[model samples]
Target: MDGRRSDTRERIRAVAMELFTERGYEKTSLREIAERLGVTKAALYYHFRTKEDIVASLSDDLRRGIDDIVSWADATPAGPERAQEILTRYGALLHGLGRDMVRFWHENQPAFRELGFGVGLRYQFRVLADLMTAPEHAPLAVFHARQALLALSWSISMMGDLPLDDDECYGAASAIASDILRRM
Candidate 1:
C-alpha cells in the first residue's frame, strides 16, 4: 500500500514537471497537471495541494542531497583532491536527480526566489565552496571552487539542447570543471 502511494506521488510529480515545462511554471495549473495525469484534481490534491508544493518537494530532495555532500566533506581532509571529489559528487547528484528538475530550477529562478528556496541553496553552495578550501578558505581558491560547482550546474540547465548525450555533455562539463579547480 505504501509503495503504491509513493509511486502515485512520483507519477504526479513527473506529470506536473512535464506540464510545467511545456506551459511554463506560472502558466501551468493544478487542473492541467491532473488532466495530464488522467487523475481528478482531488486525487492530485491528495499528493500536492499546489504547484508550489510540487516544486518544494523537488527542491527538498536537492537540498537533502547537497546536505549529504556537505556532511561528507566535513569529515574528509580538505585539499585539491577533496575539492575534486566534491565537484564530482555534486555533478553526479545534480545529474542523477533529474534533468527536468534542474531545468525547472534554471527556468524558474523568480519562483524559487519568491518561495525562499534560493536562500538555503545559495547558503549550501557557499558551504560547499568553503569545504573545498577548508582551513585556508582563501578568497581566490573559494572563487575557483564556486566556479567549478557552477560549471557542473550550468551544464545541466544550459546545455540541454546540445547534440551530445547526457554522459558526453556531463563528462565534458566535469572535465571543464576539474580543469577550473586545478587552477586553484
Candidate 2:
C-alpha cells in the first residue's frame, strides 16, 4: 500500500511536470493536471493541493538529489580526477530525472526565480564546485568548476532538438566537462 501511494505521487508529479512544461507553469492549472491524469481534482489534491505544491515537491526532490551528490563529493578526496567523477554522477542524476523537467527549468527561469528554488540550487552548486577545487580556490579554478557543472546541466535542456540519445548527450557533456576540469 505504501508503495502504491508513492507510485501515485510520482505519477502526479510526472503529469504535472509534463503539463507545466507543455503549457507553461503560469498557464497550467491543477484541473489540467488532473484532466491529463484521468483523475478527479480532489484525487490530485490528495497528493498536491496546488500547482505551487507540485513545483515545490519537485524542487524539494531535486534539492535532496543535489544534496546527496554534494555529500558524496564531500566524503571523497578533492582533486581533478574527483571533480571529473563528480560531474559524471551529476550528469547521471539529471538524466535520471528526464529531459523535460530540465528543459522546463531552462525555459522557465522566471517561474523558478519566483519560487526561490533557483537561488538555493545555485548557491549549493557553487559550494559543491568550491569543495571540488578545495585548498587553492582560485577564481579561475572556481570558474572552470562552475563551467563543468553548467555544461552537464545545460546539455540536458539545450540539446533537446538533437537526435542523440540521453546516454550520448551525457557522454558528450561528460567529455566536455572533463576537459574543462582538466584545464583547471
Candidate 3:
C-alpha cells in the first residue's frame, strides 16, 4: 500500500514534468497537471501544493542523490579509483532522474535558479571535483576533471537527438571520464 502511494506520487511528478516541458514551466499549472493525470486538483495537492513543489520535489531527490555521492567520496580513500567510482555513481544518478527532468532542467534553467535548486547542485558538483583532484589540486588536473564531469552530465540532456542510445552515450562519457582521471 505504501509502495503504491509512493508510485502515485511519482506518476504525478512525471505527468507534471511532461506538462512543464511541453508548455514552459511558467505556463504549467496544478490544474493542468491534475487534468493530465486524470486526478482531482485536491488529490494532486495531497502530494504537491504548487507547481514549484513539483519541481522542488524532483530537485530535492536529485540533491539527495548527489549528497550520497559526496558522503561516499568523503569516506573513501583519496585515489583515482574513488574518483572513477564517483563519476560512475553520478552517471547512474542522473540517468535515474529521467530524460524529462534533464530536458526540463536545460530548458528551464532560469526558473530552477529562481527556485534555488542551482546553488545546492552546483555546490555538490564542486565537492565531486574536489574529490577527483584533491590534495595536489593542480590547475590543469582540476580543469580536466571539471570537463569530464560536464561530459558525463551532458550525456543526459544534450545527446537526445543523437544516433546513440542512453547506455551507449553514458558508457562512452564514463570512459572519457576514466581517461581524464588517468591523465591527472
Candidate 4:
C-alpha cells in the first residue's frame, strides 16, 4: 500500500512537471493534471492540494539531491580530482532527477522567482561552487569553478533542443566540466 501510494505521488509529480513545462505554471490547473492522468480530481487532491504543492514537493526532492552531493563533497578532500568527481556526481544527480525539470526551471524562471526557490537555489549553488574551489579561493579559481559547474548545468538545459539522449548529454557535459576543472 505504501509503495502504491508513493508511485501515485511520483506519477502526479511527473505529470505536473510536464504540464507546468508545457503551459506555464500559472496557467496549469489541478483539474488539467487530473484529467491528463485519467484520475479524479479528488484522487489528485489526496496527494497534492494545489499546483504549488506539487512544485514544492519537486523542489524539495531537488534540494535534498543537491544537499547529498554537497555533503559528500564537503567530507572529501578539496582538489582537482575531488572537483572533477563532484562535477560528475552533480551531473549524474541532475540527470537522475530528469532533464525536464532542469529545462522547466530554465523556462519558468519567473515562476521560480515568485516562489522564492530561485534565490535559495542560487545561494546553494554558489556555496557549492565555492566549496569545490576552497582553500585557495582565488578570484580566478572561483570564476573557473562556477564556469565548470555552469557548463555541466547548461549541458542539461541549453542543449534541450538537440537530439542527444540524457546519457550522451551528461557524458559530453562531464567531459567538458572535467577539462575546465583540470585547467583550474
Candidate 5:
C-alpha cells in the first residue's frame, strides 16, 4: 500500500484500540472510532468493516509476529539458553506490535475468542512453551515454560496500574521469567 493509506490504517487501529480500552470492544462503535480519529464513518469503513475486523486486523499482525518467532525457535536447537532467548525475543515482538495491541487483546478476551484470535494466540504460546521444554516435553517443565511466557504477557496487561513504566515493567518481567526458567 501507499504511505498515506498505510498511515491511515495505522491511525484507525490506534484510535480503535484507545476507544476499545476506554469504552470496551462491545461498547465502542465504528462511529466512535471515526470520531476519535477525526475521520468520517465512511473513511473508517474504508479501512475496517466492523469492530471485530479492526481487532482481527491487529490480532492478525500479532499472529504473524508470533508465527515468525515460532519459525525462529523451530530452526534453532532447544535448551534453556534458547528458551531464555525466546523470552527476550518474545518481549521485543510484543513491544514492536505496540502495547495498545497487547493490552486490548488481554482486555477483550471474549471478543477475541469469538474471532478465533484467542485460540491462535493460545496455540502459539503452547508451541513456544513446548519449545522451551523441548525433547523432554515434561509436564512440569512445560508448566514452568508457560509461566515464563505468562510473565511477559502479564507485564503488558497486569502492570498497567503499577507505578512502573513500560521499560521498567518489561525489565522486571524478563528478570522474573529468567529466574523461573532457572528453577526448571
Candidate 6:
C-alpha cells in the first residue's frame, strides 16, 4: 500500500482504539470513529467495513508478533534460559506493539469473542506457555509459564490507568514475571 493509504489505515485504527477505550466497543460505532478521525463514513468504509475489521487488523499484527516469537523459540534450546528469554521477548512484543490494541482486546473481550479473534489468541497464548515449559512440559511448569506470561499481558491490558507510564508498568511486570518463572 502507498504510504498515505497505510498511514490513513493506522490513523483509523488508532482513533477507533481511543473511542473503543473511551466509550467501549459495543457503545462505539463506525460513525463515531469517522467523526473522531474527521473523515466521512464513506472514507472510513474504504479502509474498514466495520469496527470488527479495525480490531481484526490490529489483532493480526499482534498475532504475527507472537508467531515470530514462537518460531524463534522453536529454534532455541528449551530451558530456564529460553523461558526467561520468552518472557522478556513477550513483554517487549506486547508493549512495543502499542498498548491501545492490547488494552482494547482486554476491555472488549466479548466483542473479540464474537468476532472469533479470541480463540486464536488464546491458543497462541497456550502455545507460548507450553514453549516456556519445553522438553517435559510438566503440568506445574506450564502453570507457572502461563502465569508469567499473564503478568506481561495484564500489564499491557489492565494497568493503563495506573500512575506509572508504559515503561514503568512494563518494567514492573517483567520483574514480577521473572519472579514467577524463578519459582518454577
Q: How many residue pairs clash in each candidate?
A: 0, 0, 0, 0, 0, 0
Give one digit per residue, the lDDT tens place, for model 1 in 13-50. 88888887778999999999999889899999999999
Tens-digit lDDT track of model 3 for 1-184: 9998899999999998889888999998899999999999999999889888889999999889988998998889887888788888988887788766887888899999999988888888888888888777788888877877887787667877888777787788788767777777
- Model 1 Cα displacement at 29 (Å)? 0.2
User: Candidate 1: minimum summed lDDT over ten consecutive residues — where?
Assistant: 95-104
Query: Which candidate number would show the highest lDDT if scored against the true structure?
Result: 6
Judged by whole-model lDDT over C-alpha atoms, candidate 4 comes out at 0.86
Quote each prediction's TM-score. Answer: 0.97, 0.95, 0.93, 0.95, 0.95, 0.96
lDDT by residue (tens digit), candidate 6, 59-145: 998899999999999999999999999999999999887676778888888998999999999999999999999899999999999
3 against 6, candidate with superior lDDT: 6
lDDT of each: 0.90, 0.86, 0.85, 0.86, 0.85, 0.91
Candidate 3 overall lDDT versus native: 0.85
Considering TM-score, which of the candidate structures 3 and 5 is the better prediction for this target?
5
Please identify model 1 stretches exceeding 4 Å from their true place: none
Q: How much lDDT does candidate 5 score?
A: 0.85
Question: 147-172, model 2: which lDDT tens digit per residue?
Answer: 99999889888998999988898789
Candidate 3 regions with alpha-carbon error over 4 angstroms: none
Model 2, residue pairs in steric clash: none
Candidate 4, superposed: residue stretches over 4 Å from native: none
Candidate 2: segments with Cα more than 4 A from true spot: none
lDDT of 4 by residue, 1-184 (tens): 9999999999999999899878988899999999999999999999999887898898887788889888988899988777777777778878888888888877888988888888878887887778778878888888888898888888888897899998898899888987887777
